[model samples]
Target: MTTVAFVLAGIAALIHVYIFRLESLAWTDPKTRAVFGTTAETAEVTKPLAYNQGFYNLFLAIIAVIGIAVGAFGSASSDDVSTALIHAACGSMVAAALVLATSDSSKLRGAVIQGVAPALAILALLLS
Candidate 1:
């Protein structure tokens, strides 16, 4: 049970890191910018929003990574704290998925698949 939990949470954290990398690193490149469906003008226009959102995601991912590490490796005394932090991360992920879905329905399919998967993951952890 413990190993399963750690593996799942660690994968989630790593995925978050990958997402942050996509948002922060990839979008900066002119070539990758096109993949984001942004023209040069639009990219410049939404630069601040993109930058802020990327930063927020980076911090969120870092928190999630810490939570996973703590949950897996921290002492028994810190279990509750680690769980609480991961729960917070889960909540944030759900929120972010919703926001993405609503704003970019094409990218994430607003609350359908995107929201469902993470919600299920969080539920699994909670109910386990």
Candidate 2:
């Protein structure tokens, strides 16, 4: 369970960073723009949804770091580490997903990643 959490959290961090890049000037850089299908025009007018995504991602990265740090510090109990981190991560995901779902309704993957994965992860942890 810990391994699964770590891997997913790490991947989520990486992906969120990428999303941030796309929202920031990374979309302006030709080299960076190629990967995300963005253009300079977008750099001038960032979408609200994208900004929200970026903001959530920033929080996600911080939460992921906290999760790993707590694990390393030997505080994986319910009241201390595991419960707090998992609950936070799941909550972040749910909020992001809801924002995307209600705001845009186009970024299905964003909705799923942010909305669905966290709840499912929590359920899995409970079952285990």
Candidate 3:
């Protein structure tokens, strides 16, 4: 159960890292813009907002990674703390996805891509 939880959460972290790169470093790049279906001009106009949003994704990834590390190696007394961290990080991911879906049904696929692994990790942790 622990391994499953870790693996799923790690995947979620990696996904967010990719999102960070796309949003922060490549938002105006043609290929990145295509991935996001944004015109170059639109990308340029929204660059600052995307850059800021990218940091939010990075911070969530950091929290998830820290939770994984603590769950794997911290003292026994830290179990509750580790679990809480993991839940908070994963919960935020799920919440963000839900918001995206609610904002625009067209974004449902993106929402699922962003949220599924973390949702699974949370479920695995709870069932364990």
Candidate 4:
């Protein structure tokens, strides 16, 4: 269960890192615009906001990755801290997805994409 949790969290972290790239590095790119369903003008106008939001995603992913690493390789004394980090990071991801899904019905698919792996990781961690 612990391994499963770490693997799922790793996947969620990777997904967020990809999201960060799309949002921060390529927000105005045609492909990214298409993925986000945004017009060029809107993308341009929202670029700053997206850039900042992308960092938030990146930070969450970092926290999860760090937690996975600590849990896997850190000293026994650090186990509780690693667990807390994982829960905090993945919980934030799930909460953000829930907010997005509730705020806009059309974004449900995106919400699921954003949330599922982290949610599963949390569940597996609990079972572990």
Best by TM-score: 4
Clashing pairs in 3: none
Per-residue lDDT of 16-112 in model 3, one digit per residue for the tens? 8898999998999999988788998999999999999998889989899999999899998887877888888888888988998899898898899
How much is 56 displaced in model 4, in angstroms? 0.3
- Which parts of model 4 have CA positions greater than 4 angstroms off? none
Off by over 4 Å in 1: 109-117
TM-score of each: 0.77, 0.66, 0.96, 0.98
lDDT of candidate model 4 versus the reference:
0.96
TM-score for candidate 1: 0.77
Q: Rank the candidates by lDDT, best first.
A: 4, 3, 1, 2
Where is the poorest 10-residue window by lDDT in model 1?
Answer: 109-118
Candidate 1: C-alpha lDDT: 0.65
Tens-place lDDT per residue, model 4, 44-122, is 9999999999999999999999999999999989889889999999999999999999999988999999999999999
Q: For model 1, state the Cα shift of residue 80 in Å.
A: 0.6
Residue pairs clashing, model 4: none
Compare candidates 1 and 2 on TM-score and give the better one. 1
Task: Please state the error at residue 58 of candidate 3 in Å.
Answer: 0.3
Greater lDDT among 1 and 3 belongs to 3
Model 1 lDDT, residue 122, Cα:
68
